[model samples]
Target: MAKSVNQATQAKAKADAVGQARALAPEVPARIGSTPATKFRGNPEIFGRLVEDHDKHRALLAMIEATAPNDPARKALFEEFVRDVHGHAAAEEQALWSTVMRNPETTEFARHAVGDHHKLDKLMADAAARDITSPGWLTHFATLKDEYLEHILEEETEQFLEAEKVLSEADQRYMRKVFERRKKAEKAAAVIEKKIALKPVA
Candidate 1:
């Protein structure tokens, strides 16, 4: 009976973990009012927008991973992922994390979050150095995807809450405007970069 009870508990625990992870999984935005033209007016709107970006990043990473390394399309997909991830990180740093770093208590967490971006960029660089068909490239990419998902979870659960303690209502409203504006500009720049990348070398 004890053994059976232990087995049941383990199964329940696994189910809970799966559910929590799914809550973070990429999907159609449960977050409303985030249509392409929607402008974030406050902190809650900003937070929702960030979550939507996170969802899309994860979905893209999964799609890339599913494609074999030898597939011709892999490079283009990876390039898209790079643009989105890098652009999001840059804009978030400029608009959101900068404010978070202002608070003494949140400064360390903010720095760590930024450091994760550096680490991810390095991982991407390592992957780019290899033949996409090689096992080494896939290994690097898998590690990157795993770490990227963890970073997303950390930002939502830990950094955002800590930062909010230091941000005033007015600050949040101002930051929301900045975050949305910067993200739009970043996305436009990324689209241009993607087009350039797709262009054949002369």
Candidate 2:
């Protein structure tokens, strides 16, 4: 409940800051730590849905960076981001990237993305060890942000395009179902892990 209130307050503060900045310059990107608005939708299509998730991840990362480490909001937001990253990576690997890998034309790109997920999982494990408010945690978070940004940019620029070119409408419809199913399973597992981790030591 408190976390929800904090999030709402923080979002309002961010919006106000952007509004003020726009009133001043009217030309620059809205404000510090703001991400671009998403152009994707809720329907779990291969490209658009993935892009939507990426946009939300970017927004959550930005919010996490903007937050003070001591704030409860920071920890809450970071946990959400972690769950999202894990679920999206797992599902994309099982569904979208696997399909892309089958096409000789996109095999290399698919492999690169899968390799990133492996490296990122390792990084996430390390980040999970640090105190939310500690300097080490912030460093880990920043590094994760950098790597995530690069991966998403690559996907936006090249990977999804390749998949679209190689995949038919029917193929995407099937892949979308698989992606949604896999994402849900992974996300549920993430929630369970979080719950178990938070339980008092026996």
Specify the highest-TM-score model's number: 2
Minimum summed lDDT over a 10-residue window in model 1 is located at 33-42
* Runs off by more than 4 Å, candidate 1: 1-44, 187-202
> Each prediction's Cα lDDT score?
0.63, 0.66
Give all candidate RMSDs, comma-separated: 11.9, 11.0
Give the local distance difference test score of model 1: 0.63
Please give, for residues 1-202, the per-residue lDDT of candidate 1 as tens digits.
0012243443343334333323443331222112221122111445545655675666566666766667765776677677777778888898888878888889998999999987777666666655778766777677777788888878877777677677776676677688878877886686312111132121
- Give all TM-scores, in the order shown: 0.68, 0.73
Candidate 2: tens digits of C-alpha lDDT, residues 109-159? 899989988766666666666677875577767887788888887886667
User: Candidate 2 regions off by >4 Å?
Assistant: 1-44, 191-202
Candidate 2: which pairs clash? none
